[model samples]
Each structure stands twice: as structure tokens, then as C-alpha cells.
Target: MQLVVARIGRAHGIKGEVTVEVRTDEPELRLAPGAVLATDPAAAGPLTVASGRVHSGRLLLRFDGVQDRTAAEALRNILLIADVDPDELPEGEDEYYDHQLVDLDVVTVDGVEVGRITEISHLPYQDLFVVERPDGTEVLVPFVERIVTEIDLDEQRAVIDPPPGLIDDRAEIASSRASREEA
Candidate 1:
């Protein structure tokens, strides 16, 4: 299987180096030197990593045969893909691959069927799971330990404990909370 590992950003310097927005958690291993990655456009690569370095909290990489700023700029916004084995898992116990989470059934702690995970969105601070409800509507569920309690791969489901108004409409949640408080 092929997984998107990074996206080529603007050229960093005049030495063929380009900044990359890393998608994979294991950048040191996946984006290492001599690693050959396929490009999204299907014509920009397969670009081999000639060298890589962390500069001012950003990852910069230079590809083989891509020298100078002009050459690096030409590859801007291109996505880098890596060939991965389907059975390969992440090193960390709690870490999960985006492919593994996608398509899993989403349910509340009370066993209420909510939706199915359609996609995983990785942000700088947190990750979110895009869930498609049975009614065909979509909801963004924050992939946090507090909200998402468990991921049962064997059962093909994700158990979530969402806060009031998280899954339901805010007005409904507000009225329900008020009624409970009154009682």
C-alpha cells in the first residue's frame, strides 16, 4: 500500500533544499536520506532524499539531482508518498495508522451507533476523525483520549465518550442539561 508521508513546501535555500510538511509520525525513519519516495503528480518523482535536516523547528530536505532554488521551487506543493506494507504497524502501542482508523464504526459509550470514520485529519495540535453518520451527514470528532475511549480493531469499532452537545445539537443539549439541573 502507498501512504502519503509528506508534502513539499516552498524552497528553503538556494541549495536545492525544500521545506516539508511531514505527515508521518516517524519522519526520521520514513524521510531518511537515500529513501526514494513517489510524488503525487506522478511526474515530479520518485525523488530520492539526498539529505535532510531540521532547521528552526522545520524539516528541510534536498533531493538528488535537484540543485538550486529554482529546481526546488518547481516541486512545491507536491505530495510525497511511501510504499508501505499493509501489516506493518506503528512502533508506539497507542499510535495508529490513518488507514487503520478509517472505515471503523463509531459508537458512543452507551452503545449508541453514531457513525463510521471516513477520514483522519492531522492537525498541529490534535487529530480529528471525520465521521459519516447513518443519515449521510458528517461530523468532526476530535481524536483525543478524553473523547475517544477505545479503538477495538478486532471488532472494527471506536468507542467515544463525547461531552454534552458534542454529537447532538447544541440547543438540544442545552435544554437537556437545564432540565437535569432543575431536577
Candidate 2:
């Protein structure tokens, strides 16, 4: 599977250089000259990293075929992807990627299958799972250590002990909060 590692921000210089906002934690280690990256399907075709270097904590990349400012400017907002095997990822006991969690079956401790994970929210402190139930209700379950006790990526299932008042009510709460703020 290919995962996004960076997004082209803007043309950095007049010589076909573009500033890249790297999404990976190890940006310096991941992106380098000769690296092959696939642009997001919505943006354009895959491109090989012609040359790249860290500049001011961001990556300045030059694609193989892109030359001049006009060409580089056309790549802005394009996501860079790399082919990665999920099984090859070195994960700790409880750690998981947002991609791995998406579309996984979410079940309660009592063996009640609740829904499937449709999205993962990156909060300031922790991640949250957005589970879409069969009835179209969305559950916002915090992906905390205690709440999410088990994750089986191979089985595509997750065991969660949702905190009190955290499930099956996100839509109402969000709407109520929005209405209150507006008033």
C-alpha cells in the first residue's frame, strides 16, 4: 500500500524547486535525492525525487521532469506517496496508524459489534476513532490507552471500552454545541 509522506506547498525558487511539508515523522531520513514518490492520484502522476534537501526544517524537492517556476508551481498541494507494506512497519504493542484503523470493525468488550471505523481524528492530546454505525449514526470514541485495549489489524477489528457518554451521540452534541456557540 502507498502512504502519503508529504505535500508540495509552493514553489520555493525560480529553478523548479518546491517547498514540501513532510508528513512523516522522520522527514530527513525518509525523503532524499533519488527517492521515488507518487503524487496523489487527484493531483498528477508519480514523480521521482530528482534532488531534495532539508531547508529550514522543510524539504525542498526538485522533480525529475519538472523544470522552472511555472512547472514547480503546478505541483503545489500535491501529496507525495511511497509504496509501503503495512506488515513491514515496526509497531509497538499498542501503536497503530490511522490508515490501519480505518474501516476496521469496532466492537465492545461484551462482544457487541458496534460499527466500522470510518475516520481517525487527530486531537491535540490523542487520536479519536469515528465509527459509522449501521443506522448511520457516528460514534466518536477516543483512542486512549485504556479505552482501546486491543487492535487486530489482520482481522480488521478493534476492541474498545468507550468512556461513559462518548458513543452514538457525536452528531447531536456537535450540532448542539454549534447552535449554542452561534447563539
Q: What is the TM-score of each candidate against the true structure?
A: 0.82, 0.61
Please give, for residues 1-183, the per-residue lDDT of candidate 2 as tens digits.
877778898998899999987655345545777777777765586788888876776669898889899999999898988776777653476566666778999998887888999877654356678899988878788887799878988788999888767664577789989999999
lDDT of 2 at 22: 62
Cα-based lDDT for every prediction? 0.92, 0.79
In candidate 1 the C-alpha lDDT for residue 116 amounts to 98
Top lDDT model: 1
Q: Which stretches of candidate 1 lie over 4 Å from their true place?
A: 134-137, 170-183
For model 1, residues 7-100, the per-residue Cα lDDT tens digits are: 9999997999999998776788889999999999999999999999999888999999999999999999999999988899998899998888
Best by TM-score: 1
